[model samples]
Target chain A: MNILEIKDLHVSVGGEQILKGLNLSVEQGSVHAIMGPNGSGKSTLANVLAGKPGYVIDRGEIHFDGDLLNDVDPEVRARAGLFLAFQYPVEIPGVSNMEFLKAAVDSLAAARGGEQTTAVEFVKSVRKIATALDLNPEFLKRGVNEGFSGGERKRNEILQLLLLNPRLAVLDETDSGLDIDAMQTVADGINRFRDAHNCVLLITHYQRLLNHVVPDVVHVLSDGVIVKSGEKDLAVTLEERGYAWLTD
Target chain B: MADRLEDSFAESLIANLDSSSGSWLAVEEIIDRLKSSLTPAATKESWKYTPLRDFLVGFTGAAAVTPDITGVNQPGLTMSALSAAGEYARGPAALANTGPLPLADAALLCAGDAVHIKVSGEIAQPLEISYGEGVQVPIVITLEDNASLQLIERNNAVEFCNHSLFVELNRGSRLNHARSALDSNCCDWGLTQVRLLETTDYRLQQYHTGARKRRAETLILLDGRGARAELTGAYVVESNSHLDQQFIVEHRSPDTFSRQTFHGIGAGKGTIVFNGRIHIHPDSPGSDASLVNKNLALHPEATINTKPELEIYTDDVKCAHGATVGQLAEDSIFYLRSRGLSRDDARTLLCRAFLKSCIEGVLAEEVTEALLRNLTGP
Candidate 1:
């Protein structure tokens, strides 16, 4: 069975139509990339799939692991193994990152009807993950993403991705604003998250990230529809020709 | 409605204290205050936001607390009763006795004998003045030159209590004062007044989990140069309970500093009110003061009134204050929920975090955790 299937998915924001009857599918253990120019509804696709607020779905069907997710709340969708790494992750003032991770991990575990991780074991596990992402252990004590630089915020998202270990990860422009070294580290984290039973969806405007983490399939989204789907060469073609040729 | 309750409440409390051993002079000030308390409605400027007429039904038929605190194990400490030992009676205190508020006078009239605490040198274990049972009690504390001490005051589970705490710190003296009060169907009033001397530091922290009707007031006077005061308070009121916190800080001398951070949360039909006033007197050119009051109303039916009142008599002082009344941030909540917390769990986490930073310098971890648990629980 496909890990994610979107059929006739029409989504809008602020009464403006963005994703107009978009359709796509991702099989288990496969990595799919959606590359489009600015405002071609790349982030909107990730948001709609993660159940973000303020998005009006005119018509659509979203199935994750054979379960219909259109009516589910954002948190419920998250517990059901759908994760979205936001392009601009929010900075919460008082909620410490470690505290947030503990609560988040616990929530996911509880939703899965599994035993909660002990605080000691969880701390040990998260510290290892934080170190792998080159994050200061002290950063875990600070407010979530507060006072973090652009690169730090992006890396922090990767830390969550590694810690949560969701079955389907939707990364929205995770490569933007990252330096080469940071981009390589994030790619490594994403590569680490790839598993046989999980699916990975990458949303980007450039093909640079695709070089580090190759995509099994690439989809070109324009005006809310997947106009084209191809193998890795399609990304190189778009990077060389730009998005105008496809629209024209 | 409040006027009638005030009159009757004052009458019965006064009668009870008159039956005690206290001199008429002590109770006379109370009589004067009670007479003036009825006319000025809670709708007046200072008490405008507080729904006291509807919530503050004065306590009736409650007894006065006999001063039982004595001979604390800590060194450089002593205790006495104001009514029994006239020398221990510290008169003309500030706060509720400041010409307008009547609760302090009623407390003085009702208290069998207010506790008088004296510290002369470096004190170890905190001197505690607790109303462990159901009674109204008043306490007066004086720290001599170069003396330092801590006071852990616990007043909870009382039917009705109107108490006053007076603290005077001499040159280079310091005091750490902490109080915890969490009870219901209880009309509780706590008024604390502090006078700081040269180079003295006074820190007071009060935590409450609500009551039927409650008001916790802290008034600090930085009377000498280089004196500093840090005051923080947090309260949680739910159901039909009411919680009011008033912080009055005055920099009376140059180079003095005062800071106050307050947090209050309300759920159900409860009302939480915070009134923080900072007065930088003239000639105190080098004074620095700040007052911040933040409130969170958990349920739609809950209400919060937060006001930071600044009265500056000089242009040379640096003063800042801010008050914000908001519920849990939608984005913050969503962020937490997305991580795995249910909506309710996310709300609890935010509420707990709100109360954590506000209750500072509390030595007893269990006390602080207990208060946190009470507030975060449904």
Candidate 2:
């Protein structure tokens, strides 16, 4: 079953065309890698999927779990199980990480007509994920993304990804600013999160992260549209030869 | 013109004064200063952003004085009536001549005596003082050597009120002061002056929801070596409200330290003003002072004016000052929305975070609710 379907999606920002006539589809229970050079609209695609404002959807349609997503609010899309790990996570001081996580979880639960998690249960679950990601529990008391190191910010993003447990997770360059150890920890988290019930949309410029999670499908995006699609071997070829050969 | 109003106000005060009102020794000094010092006009640099005309209009009528007290009896604390406190009231009474303090002078002139509080040892319980209902309150506090106290002041009355507070922290003494003003349709005027001795510590946490018109002036003097002062304030201005705050910290002794941080929000067609000034004297060589004032404008029609000024006479001191006026970051709002929070929830969260640093202590929860009430639009 197709979890996400983008049919000939055309997106523009500030009256300038960025994503022109783009088409893509991700099946359920599979990982897909999107690789492109600079200015190839990789982040734009992730933002458009999250329903961020300022992007004019000139034309096309978006379907998520049989629901039209083009007109959906960002929070509505989020409650329906779509997540976007920001390339530059915002630093919100004074709002503790624990409080933010609790609000998010409760909002999602309320939207699905489920009871809110108790304090003890919520803390136990958060601690479990924090320990798995090697994150200190003390960090949960501090402001969200406040004074976090580059590697720590990436790990924090992955922490949310696993804890939220969304149907489709869009990792937008999450592995860009991480060291080898941090990268391995994040990849391990992704590996543990993928199961028969969910899918992952991995957006990146390097093939290093794919070495750990190992995408099932690889697609090359150029000038706002997918230029080629193949199996996982395509990522390795692009890493060796670069996009210059394919673009020319 | 403000000059005409000042003359009439001063005349009315003198005509209404009772023979008992002049019992205090500081009354003569206050009266002299009231006549000599002109009411603040918009042309003056210190009163540039504030509209004194609106403030003077509230004082045109007769004054009704209501006196009351609460939460003063506790261990290691002593309270005395101002008339019986004797020479102790002399110091605070002289403070009326410090500047063009019309409101402070008016409060002290009408007030025959004030509440005098003296702390000898560390007190665990906080002291509460309430002011409002056309009442003018003058308070004097003294912390002996190594003594400590927590003071909380609040006013919820619907009528205009004036408050004057004077604090003296002796050697090695400490004081934690907090105040909240959360009425929607009232007028308030307050003046706070503190003197810190050697190695003494003083901290103030002030929270407010703008009234019909409000003005607060605070002065902290580090008079002894190794003295320290910390001041934090947060306010929210809504429809038909006007708030003006002036904070001045002076380092008069060597090796003194002071920090001032304030955050405010403008959510209606109101006006908000903040002026923070730090002065380092020539003899104060090792002074370290920092001031920060940040403001957020939730509505374009609201007016926010902030200025941070620094004056250093010595070259061997560290001083940093900054002021900013802006709107909430769109990126932050979108980030929160993407995490499953609605737009309104995201705004409330961000607004609360923006003011979290300045609003704290026993009344944090209550003050937070009041400040965010009109801010989070319906």
Candidate 3:
């Protein structure tokens, strides 16, 4: 079963075309990595899948977990097991991390007709996940991403992904700005969440993260469309040669 | 031009007043001044957006005084109604110089009896006062040096209410006061005055909601060095309700610190207005003051007007003021909703967070919690 299938995906932002006739398909349980240079509409694809506003869909069809979404709100898409780890996680001051996570988890589970976890069990599980991700347990008491360092923000996003267990996780540059140990911890989390019933769409620039969370398939995006596709070696080759050769 | 009907409408309130009505001379003085100023909402340099005329119209001519006082008298507390015998043991000194507004003066002129709170030692339990429907009374609180008190005053099911509260904190004294007015179809008006002596600490948080027109104005004076004050407020209105508040925080001594934060939410065709002013008097060097006012217009027809004014006369002082009148942050809302929460739940969470930011600095956790529950539904 395909968890996500995008057909002729054409997206525009702020009166400009960003994703022009892009196509992609992620089979259930497979990890797909889309690598691109700056301005290649990589982030645009992630945002469009997450159902952000202001991005006009010129023409496209997105089927998530076998459900076609032509007019689904962002929250609806999220409850449908769609998750996007933002490139820059938004900072919501005055909302404790614990409160936000609890609401989020509850919404996701309730939408899927799953039983809710008690507050105590939720805290214990979240604490274990935070510790494994090298995140401070005390951070749960603080405001969401308020005054956190860049690395800390990235780790916090991973913490959400680990706990949510979404069917499709679109991580936009989740490994950026992280030290070596932190990157390894995040990669381990991604690896643990991978299974035959879920999918991962990893959008990134550097190949450093692909080492730990090696993708099953790699695609190079340029000018809003895929220009190259290959195995894991494609990322290593692109890493060494860079996008200059393909563009010229 | 001031309308004679409006001026006379205010005049009618002073006629046949309750025990709150003090000396005839003071009452006459207040009435005479209304002919010109008429309690603001004019083209005056300050107070332009608030149309006091609409509010004063809720004044049903005569003040309604509800003299019901319940609850046990704790060891460190004293309670009274406006007309009970010997209530005059406390004079009008607590209510003096606290009012220049016609409504405030009019409310004072109707003062029948007063509830006085005198604290000379530390009190851990909170003191609550509920003035029944249309209760007109002045609350006087005096704290001796090295003492502290927590108080909550509530006005329920009232119309044309004029309650006065005065607090004086001596050296090293701390006082936390919370006032709320939430009666539908009522016009509630309140006046609060505070004097902070040397090393005295003062904090006040108010939540006003549900009235056809509700207004509370507070005047605080930082009178000695090392004095500190933090005032937080929230106004919630829906379905044609109106909430207005004006605050004046005066820094009179060096090393004094004061902060003010006010948040308002208007859901229907309601109107919310707040004017906060922080005055750094001359020679009050090393004083630090800041004021922030924000309002959320949940409905397109809802009106929100927020202003933060700073009058700095000392060059060595630090002062900052800011105000914003708009809807909730679209980005925050989107972020929350995108995380799987329903749209309504998303808005509730964001709105609660916005309100918490206003009063989180206060030391009264229980008071702040109760206020949050009142402002934002369960």
lDDT of 2 by residue, A38-99 (tens): 99999999999999999889999989987889989999999999999989998998999999
TM-score per prediction, in order, is 0.91, 0.93, 0.88
RMSD of each: 3.0, 2.7, 3.9
Score each candidate by Cα lDDT. Answer: 0.78, 0.84, 0.77
In candidate 1, what are the lDDT values of residues B119-210, reduced to their tens digit? 89998776766665444566778899999887888775466666677788999999988888877667776777888989999888878877
Give DockQ per model, in order.
0.66, 0.79, 0.78
| Model 2: number of backbone collisions | 0
Name the candidate that leads on DockQ: 2
Model 1, runs deviating above 4 Å: A113-115, A118-120, B1-18, B24-44, B50-63, B67-71, B83-101, B132-135, B367-378
Pairs of residues at least 3 apart in sequence or in different chains that clash in candidate 1? none
- The residue ranges of model 3 lying beyond 4 angstroms of the native Cα positions read A244-248, B6-47, B55-101, B112-117, B145-147, B360-378
Model 2 quality (TM-score): 0.93
How does residue A177 of candidate 3 score in lDDT? 86
**Model 2 chain B: which ten-residue window has the lowest total lDDT?**
B84-93
